[model samples]
Target: MAKDISVPFSYTKDGIYYFERRVPRDLQKHYSASKIAYSLRTRSSSVAASRATRAAQQLDEYWYHLRIKGSELPGKHLLRMQQNATKAPGSLLPSEHDDNATVSQSEAVAIYLRLKGQNRPVTFHRAAERACGYVIDVCGDKDLLGYSKADATRFRDAFIERKLTGSSITRIFGTVRSVVNLAASEVGVNITNPFTGVYYDRQSGVIERAPLPADVIKAVQRECMKIDDDLRWLVALISDTGLRLAEAAGLLREDLVVDADIPHVVVREHPWRRLKTCTSARVVPLTGMSL
Candidate 1:
């Protein structure tokens, strides 16, 4: 004996036939099977049945695609239904997934703004906006969340072809990856970040030290002598004491102390301005000169 197979079906009040498997569960709440069948019956019983059946199939396909893409159910079914009714023949409905399914370049920018509102830094948001814009410019009408590996690879190649600096390219790619990860979480979609495996070249670090030859030191000292005596003293204090320029500049008259037993300076806050560093406020021995 053969096993029995049961396929769901819907019927109109006027006795028109339609398939139930095609109708999405989300749509069934607002649009009853009988109502859809009756609406089709007004045209022609046979034609109505076919139309209802096709509509059901379309809904099924849309839901299937959303499932494959790992997207969540849209918040509003009636709005989605209206959009579906107006779509061109063979065109997918926008409500099959979230509004973020196939985002416009402008919409991508809006996503960045939302991230910024959550306390993301301005630089991160700006870079994400730019990367998404570039992706949209290259791949028109394609869902970024559902982009294939080939698409991601091609986009990486395109960026490289533009001859942008490696660091700049890396920053943009990093921003895109972060945005996509965040969007995926928000929409309940699981997508492979395009920038996951991409790497950028790093430039060598070079150190430039100031020259300190004896002849150069003599020339600098001669130049310092041409200035006022007070300025010359400041220069000498910095050179001998290894004090930072700001610390030397912050010294005050009261800070200069002269006692036979302990000849040292006592730096204090001057005119309500504190020293740049705690070390700058300490007393130091006056070995070579008197105050």
Candidate 2:
């Protein structure tokens, strides 16, 4: 005997209906079945019920088809329907819009992830996330994808007032621009790229001064020698080689190359590894002091 499910629809303005279904516990994780249920809740009753019936039928047709093919249906069809309902001509019938009025913020984030994929680096992703958070905090449930140029300008002013550095401001604005661009493309909203004409003051560049003066270096070295011989060697290595503090800290025992004819240190992908450019990867010839 085939199991029966009860789907409920509620009536409201314009004679439209909203739906809910009593799904079987055993099929809770079934992609097609869950998708159908999710669809029914957002679509107009007649359409929702029809799609639900089709999805349920498809579920029984072939297990692999339902699992693999059905997963695509929710993202493509259901999400599209929800997007349409939001921008549908005229106000959606109360029942039609009730459960589908605003796209969930989580949905926006999911779309952002799909847009970013693996194309963006971790730093870019982090910056985008920070911008998204600011948008959500300021706009609440409002759709940031639909924000106007004026809105973006307001955000920029607010960010500046918070005393963020020019570089930091640029990074945050860049993230906002990417999210808005992707959101506009995916959600069919026309949004202005806030960072398009924006400019931040670039402060005078400061040169990185070498670590300590000779007197301070000697004093520190003398202090280190009295405390621990290992620390003394570490201080000597940095003072002699001009390696960055982090690179020195992260150096491993295996990174020490004592057999080279020129006796240079090999920094090829070491624990303390930051090369300014491809040209920075060459060996640094050791002096008698470094040895």
Candidate 3:
């Protein structure tokens, strides 16, 4: 039998935990969320619990604020400008209903860019902005809390219209969602993310990278043998050892264990370049033209 799975503010599926809730219909207009099925973005239940607890705290405060305001908060649940003159003598003011921070999608993207800028490359930041730009274009500007499943659906349809592959579309959605989620969590914004469950069509549209044909490799090798430059050696090295373009370009003379019992190329980080991942740092056995 399947494991009996239950938690106070979360649920598990496929080894990942998700925060789930059904926003009361009367309160949905104010929160701008119908249902919350946000992935805590973790496989570990403990981590998911921590994240879910934070989300739940925010939601609880929202519910409390709603009850405190009673029926005074007006029209389509929009917070109207203060009308002190029209108010009952001792009624609670609109100011009292200011329960959460309100950030527009544009403003959130700016914050995301600023916070992410120092750590990541400019190209990465630019790509993130483009991804966010597409979202704002499709969804229209709204407060963070105002994003909904309808917006996600619209964005998905728009991407499909553009003929973007499922992987590309999913990546665009996921990037913006990640930015929003991080910003909301870090900046103490109380919002339910619509993009969490709006992932792209899975796996099918992923185009796998294939290796060069043996004849093509041979043709390149024959040509590289004629050129007497670093390009020639790079072509030769990859042709035989299959080293990544960066790994070959970033190589140092010391990284070549040519004198060892079994010659190898040590794919390690250098002052000029770092391995993309820890696993990228390894010893690749050398042979053929690479020797």
Q: Considering every candidate listed, which one attains the maximal lDDT?
A: 3
Question: Which is the better candidate, 2 or 3, if ranked by TM-score?
Answer: 3
lDDT (C-alpha, whole model) for all candidates: 0.51, 0.51, 0.68
Q: Candidate 2: give the clashing pairs.
A: none
Against the true structure, what is each candidate's TM-score? 0.36, 0.46, 0.60
Better of 1 and 3 by TM-score: 3
lDDT of 2 by residue, 33-71 (tens): 453322222325555456445545543443444355542
**For residues 129-151, could you state the per-residue lDDT of candidate 3 as single tens digits?**
67776665567556778888989
**What TM-score quantifies how close candidate 1 is to the native fold?**
0.36
Worst 10-residue stretch by lDDT in candidate 3? 73-82
Error of 3 at 167 (Å): 1.7
Please give the clash total of every predicted structure, in order. Answer: 1, 0, 0
Candidate 1 residues 59-175, lDDT tens each? 565467555863333211111222234334213223445655644333334444554435444454545555775564454325556666666667777766766666666766676
